[model samples]
Each structure stands twice: as structure tokens, then as C-alpha cells.
Target: MNIRGKLIIIGGAVDKGSFTETDLDKNVSNNLNFFEAGILRRVLVEAKHQEKSRIEVITTASKIPREIGPEYIKALNYLGATNVDVLHIERREQATDPEVLERLKAADVVMFTGGDQLRLTSILGGSLFHDILLDKYQNEDFIYAGTSAGAAAASNNMIYQGSSHEALLKGEVKITSGLGLIDGVIIDTHFVQRGRIGRLFQSVVGNPRTLGIGLGEDTGLLITNNSRMEAIGSGLVILVDGRQIKDTNLTEIELGQPISVNNFAVHVLSKFDTYDLKTHKMHIQSSQYI
Candidate 1:
């Protein structure tokens, strides 16, 4: 099915004016705040209007929703947004609240913040709110944005648990169903900084038909039609294609065993680079994002 909405999947730590959290690797010396490299401004630009369009920041996955919600508001306000609001769906019952669904329906852009992906799926998945959101995104002029856990959970399949150190081992990476915003693709955040390439590889190797995307810190992809992906932000976006695999013992391997695979294709993209999910090819945009 073709989708009309936009998907902005970010790698997190994109200087929301109050962003100071370290990535999965605990790197404290990130030099991203000094310039205009953050993707929040692009989020505002992606919306229909800066002043009038309502942008809803959903913080269901965040443990500190009260804190993260306001940070997004501050960041969007800085980008000239005047009609921004925060929604914290703390429980399953809250997902079915009439007022909450109405608020979401009125929003032009709904962004999911970084946190626990499981919380988002368990709480909002299969609910009336999810139905409305999916319907609106596929039919209306809406935008769906997410960072970190939000980005990971936006896909139909999610990697809920996996350590970078043991990702290459069979069965080390655990997968689960997500919000079902997009399919035939898997997303992994903090790819460069956290060394999560292995898990993404395992994800694609397990299912060669699936494409894996690894987003670096402060980087993302602006996806449209659920097929065309334009790279955004300062860091890198890696694509893992396992469609050409010739030989592999992944199915025969036991738990914790190192699975081997051949002919895994990889692509590294920067800002402005566009990828076609249908063709499995990337188009380069000469203009530098930095």
C-alpha cells in the first residue's frame, strides 16, 4: 500500500536545545550543539506550516515523558513553531482516551520521542488510537517523525534487545513487532557511535527480503511514499541489503553460535542522499549538508 505521510526517523541526540544525554556508547565529547546540524528545524519545515500547523510530540516510550516532552516543544518553538503540544500515553487505557485520539487527529505532525520501543508498541499498538494514526498517515497530509527508540519501533519489525558486543552471534538479537508504520525494513539507531551494525546485519540476514537501516547519532532519513528515503542530519545512514546472499548457516547454527553469511551488501549515505526501497539503489545529491 502506498502511504501519503512523511517519516522522519532520527538517530537521536540532535540538539533539541536541552539535549545533553550521551549515546549508547557514552560518548561525552559530541560537538553537534554549536552549529545548526540538528534535524528539529527540518521537522518544522516538513510540517504544512510553522505557525499554524499543530505538532504533537508523543512521549509514550520515554520513561521521563514530562521532561522529554517539554524539550521537544522548546526545540520546535525555537524553530518558529507556535502550535506544538505534548502527549504522554503512560498506560494502555490512555491510548483509548477520546480526547487523546482527537488531539492526535488534529495534529499535522506527530513525533515519537526516544525511549523504550516496547512501551510504545505494548501501549499504543492495536488500539483505536493506532488505527486512527495508521488511517490518517496513509490517507491524509500528515507527518510521522521519530527518534532513537521511536525510529526503531516505527517499522513493523523491531529489535527490542541486542548488545553490540554479542550481536554477531545467532539468537543474540531479539526481534519483535512494532507500530507497523513501515514494513519490509528494520531500523537500528545509534549505529555509528554504538557499533550496532552487527545486529542490523543479523536482522537482514535472518530475512534477506528485509532491508536494514542503521542511523548514526544526530542523523536520520526523510522517508516519503514509504519507499523513497532522503538522508538528513549530520551523521551517516547505513543500509544493509541481504538479498544477494549465496550461502549461510544461520538456520543451522545454535544459540550463541556465530552465524556466517556471504554477499551482504552495504551502503553508506550522508545528508541529501536518496535511496529507493523498491530498486535497492541510492542516488547521490551533490550538495553537502555540512
Candidate 2:
């Protein structure tokens, strides 16, 4: 029961944009080569390693028909996954079942689809399902990956408060409990498109205790086996540092006020770029971000 593996969160925008052969090659160049060469095969190459055969899709927040559709399921099967279990977690009866936990324990990649993140929190909050989610992260047989709201909830601190246009002013945001698979930071998804710079600031200003991370659509951050994180996908992963802020004039902020936020620096990166969470330093690594 070796439970150590990297966690990769792909923000909403999966299967979107110009992810053609050329684009995928350009974007995931090294990873594509690995896939072609069966390099990723070793990650779960053996029958013993192949026991990770389940997928728990939390459709609690978004309608399954709308979020992922049918083609996505077929894609998983095409990838040679023997079992693909769809859990309609929104239904109260299913939500309360203990069997749900067992299914989660058997999953290889536990994917969360995009929807209202607030809805995700409201439904799974304080439930057995939430506990099982945390347990899976601790388990040796699972991998956690979320997109959109799913990506947002992976952080220790959840920024469920404030809108994209609001001021970064003080007390404008709220932090709620997430699954807590990863700690010491907050995640905000749909970063660039939603223009959520202010919201991240509001989150930090409200909490002032954790780091803030805003990931753009179609982009992902993979925390590798070496304990270093690399940005992947089409867009940039935004890192906001608030460790140096002395004070924020959020109290003086109005509804919008252009959402001015100080004491926060933003870092954007493409694939092959790495950022160390332990040392709080950003660097480019020799290794490719596959």
C-alpha cells in the first residue's frame, strides 16, 4: 500500500480550446512524448498497481449532463480504465450511503467536475462524504484531481466569498473548509477569464494566514513526486504572495473601486516552470512538466 503520488489539479477548461495535436504537442510536449512511449504506463503498469479502478465524480454542484457530458466517460474507458463509476452525490440517499466511501477507496483518479463551488461545499460539508474524501487523500490507492470548482476546493482555505469585480478591500471575502487534501494555501479557479485578482486579495486580506493561488482556466499545477510543482496545460497558473503586506485599505473600498489591492505580487507561468511551496521560491526546472 504505497500511497505516495503527485496531485494534479486541472482547472475547468478541460477538453476546450485548440487542444489539437499540434496544440497538445506544444503544450504538453514532454508529457505527450511520455504518453506515446508508455512512460506513464509504469505508474500503474502491473495488475497489482491496476487495482486503482474507480472514479468518483461529484456531480453534486453541477448537473452531470451539463458539466462533463457522455463523451468524457467514453474517453476514460478509451484510456483503458476497466471501471468507471459515476456517483450522483447530490441525491440524498446516495449521499448518505457508506458504500460511497468504499467506491472512493478504489479509485485511481478521483476527478471533480466544474460547477458552483459554493454548491459543492454546501452539499458535502460536514457529511460522511467529506470525511471519505479526506481519507482517500491519506490512502495509498487514490489520486485527487479537480477542475474548476473542484480545483478551487483542493486548497486548505476555500474562498467562497466575494465576486470577480469586488474590491480587494478588507472583510470583503470569506474562507470556508475544503476537503483539505493540500494545506497552507487557498485556490481560486477561472483566474484570468473571470478577472479574479481582487477576489484572491480579498481572501488573503480576510484570512492573512495562508497563501493565495489563482489558477487560470485550462491550466493546471502538478505537485510532482520530487515535491516540486510544475504548471501545465494551456494557460498560466497565478501565484499571489501576501506575506509582505503591512495593511490593506479594504475598509475604505466601495463595491468595486477598481478593486485595487496592494502588498500582493502575482506570478504567472507556463509549462516546465516550477514553484517550491516549502521555500516559497519560483524557478524553471530542467525537467519537463508532463
lDDT of 2 at 116: 74
Candidate 2 lDDT, 13-127, residue by residue in tens = 6643223345444443343332322312222332234535565555665766344534345444444656665666775556568788677656666667778777887777767
Give the TM-score comparing model 1 with the true structure, all chains together: 0.92
Best by lDDT: 1
lDDT of 1 by residue, 74-118 (tens): 667656789999988999999999999999989999989999998
As a whole number from 0 to 100, the lDDT of residue 159 in candidate 1 is 94
- Give TM-scores for every candidate, taking all chains together and pairing residue i with residue i: 0.92, 0.77
Candidate 1 colliding pairs? none
TM-score of 2: 0.77
Steric collisions counted per model: 0, 4
Give the runs in model 1 whose Cα sits over 4 Å from its true position: 19-37, 287-290
